[model samples]
Target: MSEIIGFAGMSHSPFATLLPPARDGEPGGRFLADSTKVGAAVTELRPDAVVVIGPDHFHANFYDQMPPFVLGVEEATGFGDFGSTAGPVPVASGLGWAIRDGLAESGFDVSLSYALTVDHGVVQSYEMATGGAGIPLVPLVLNTAAPPLPSLARCVALGEALGQAIRHAPDPGRVLVVASGGLSHWLPSNDPRDPSVVGERRSSLIHGRQDARAFAAVREPRVRAMAGNPDAPVNADWDRWFLRQLYTRDLGPIVELGHDKLEEEAGSGGHEIRTWLVGHAAAGLPLVWDSYEPVPEWITGMAIGATFPVPA
Candidate 1:
């Protein structure tokens, strides 16, 4: 059986790639330094494979056919949005297939993608956590952006199932789980199904897969615009509260908060916490170290956290 050696949850933003390297004493800079520390810890574990649980920002999966969860079974590629690297990720295909089967047995009818193309959401966390090391990984994409989304409880359940799958897999190697995205911030996303979301924006959300880069390009300006807005909100209090729940391994408040309430307090982008919940529950380990900073310049409350490694 494979062992979950470690777990990490970190906030990701394109600003980490788009803007100049953050200077010391700046929120962004502090986040970068803390992320490096978390990455180094992950590398120290030297796991056989890493499982990245993150959300897709309409780069690959779209409303054309968005599943609640997707497992990259064969190939995974990065789109390189926000100046990040674009290329194939070293996917652990055998273990990915095992996880898919395991998920199915556990009542999770997750979709499988042989050619999954992810954006900064997954890649940024992967890069930050492993420092771009050539660690084979399985990318698990969740639908956090789109509306009519899965419940937070369901995300927790999925994580529990995922952890079980990883533990019971035939491979007896070490596997690390990384969750990417969110503390508190907002994005200019609207439900494509909504009547107000007309014109090209709506079209892009529904059928953007044909030209993923073009859609990304179109959306880039909105994200960049947020960086310039001085009034962009980053709820530090909410971020700290969420981190407290994770540190204490108490998810009842998070689940009770629900999607609507989270959006109300943490902003729309806070939906990405679903990824963190999944990763936390999947690891089933204690969080040993963490750091947080409300980086309004990046339009996201930046945070980094990791779990204690299991005994080898």
Candidate 2:
């Protein structure tokens, strides 16, 4: 039988790698130190393949037909935005097919894509976890930015299904399951739905713009601007409380929080935690490592966590 050897979650904040280090005593400084420990564990646990549960920030998915969950079979590649190279990454296709079939048989209507371009979520996670060691990846994309976000309960079920699928893969071997993104974060400027935030001109450019390139031209610049800013808003209290929920192992409070409520409390970026939830459910393993620090420089309530090996 295939086995899940480990699991992890981390902040894919672009600033972690893209921007220079924050000054000592800054929140970013403290958070980066914690991140190094997570990276070190990734090297120590060394898995044959990685299954990354990451969210798309309107980069890969559009509002018209946003999939709550998607599995990239055949292959995967990324835009090379945050200190990662732009190129195709090897994908474990045999395992991908197995997961696609397993989840379907399990009654989860998940989308399977032959071509999916992952952005920072997968890129940063891969870099931090493996340091570009070139491990094969199985990318699972979750839509966190788009409205009508997947419910926390649904995320749990999806994660469980994913865990089952991984075990059933043709050659599960040693798998590193990663839930990439969140603790809690809010970026008022990055909300895609708000025309006012990006200004009416850019909003009009994005309004009903079906061309991916056209939309990206106007959208990506604003995204980069927000990411580069150090004064962006962050809710440290919310992040701390969320971390407490995880440590307590009572996700009841988080589940009770829907997308609307999460947006209000953690900002639009808060929805990224659904990716973390999926990995959490998949491993069904308790947290072995966790660090929470609100880094406004990254505009994310930065955090990371991993699961200990379950006894055979």
Candidate 3:
């Protein structure tokens, strides 16, 4: 009966773009969502262990394979990127074993080839969320940037499985579900006319309205953009639908974070970070930065969130 203490989500690229530039260990790197402010309670709650969910650029950057199919990359393969935490991550074998067995049985390709490197999306955000308190984590990677990546439906299924895995975890203490990456964003040096990043931009849209008219004619295009076409707009439907099924119980957005010009704060890429925590014995969590409200349809997204624990 272990309750999932906190269920959270954010854009994976936020840490990569925001953490490095953060001033004095603050979440100053990104403008759209600030980890320091948003995840303050997670650290304070002091859960026994965390399950960090993130994307593996290898899957997203390339196009050979789609997701729901996980690869245990050869230890020697390098992402050529400097911000990876791929070295000797203390992975929970029980969790890995479960993920492996489950993926294999589900007809998803699961590989345990070489060593896996940790990306900044995990380490940096973890650092901010927990203030480097050194919490043990069972890291799961999403092939967000790779080819043959997992679909939105599959990822949500993975999340449900993750909840089960963590619940089954023998170790005691509360467990937190942390999903990181993506709010609408545009990069620097990006041509407004170029079709390499995102398609036409829309504002003031929240994640609650499921009415056909809410998305009107914009749903499908948004999803394709999210599929990383670079020439399309991100369809919030797939991700939102998955989250709605997995957590919200068909409820609408609980928290929203979005910034118009993330580049202005951290250069290229906007930011969004939202949270969901469910726990019976949970203590009140603190807000890291002063609570902020976004200007209606403004370019910048204010960081807002919710934190509650789920007890066993």
lDDT of 1 by residue, 1-312 (tens): 999997899999988877745467764887888888777777788889999999898888889898989999999999988887799999999889989999999999999899998888999999888988979999999998868889999999999999999999997889999999898998766698678889999999999989988998889888777774546799999998898888766678999998889999899899999999999999987687778878888888999878864222
Model 2, clash count?
A: 0
> Which residue runs does candidate 3 get wrong by more than 4 Å?
1-3, 12-34, 59-61, 64-87, 99-114, 146-149, 186-247, 251-306, 309-312
Cα-based lDDT for every prediction: 0.87, 0.75, 0.40
What would the TM-score be for candidate 1 when compared with the true structure?
0.96
The estimated TM-scores of all candidates read 0.96, 0.87, 0.52
Strongest candidate by lDDT: 1
Residue-wise C-alpha lDDT for candidate 3, range 1-312, written one tens digit per residue: 344676555444422432333354233243334555555667666676666665543212222223333333222222323343434444444545554555555455554634555555455455556655666665555544312333334443444454565555454557665654443333323232334435322121222133323332453333223332224333333233323333333222221111222223322323222112211112123222222322112212223233443111
The TM-score of predicted model 2 comes to 0.87
Cα lDDT tens digits for candidate 2, 1-312: 467887878777877766646588765676667656666667777788888889876556765566789899987878666555667988878778888988997889788889888878787877677667888888999988756678999998888898998898877488888878875666544445656645644453335235545566665576668665667788889877776666544566888987778878888788898987888888877686577777776788888776752221
The best candidate in terms of TM-score:
1
RMSD of each: 2.2, 3.5, 12.6
- Could you tell me the lDDT of residue 16 within candidate 2? 75
Please tell me which model should have the higher lDDT, number 1 or number 2: 1
Q: Positional deviation of 290 in candidate 2, in angstroms?
A: 1.2
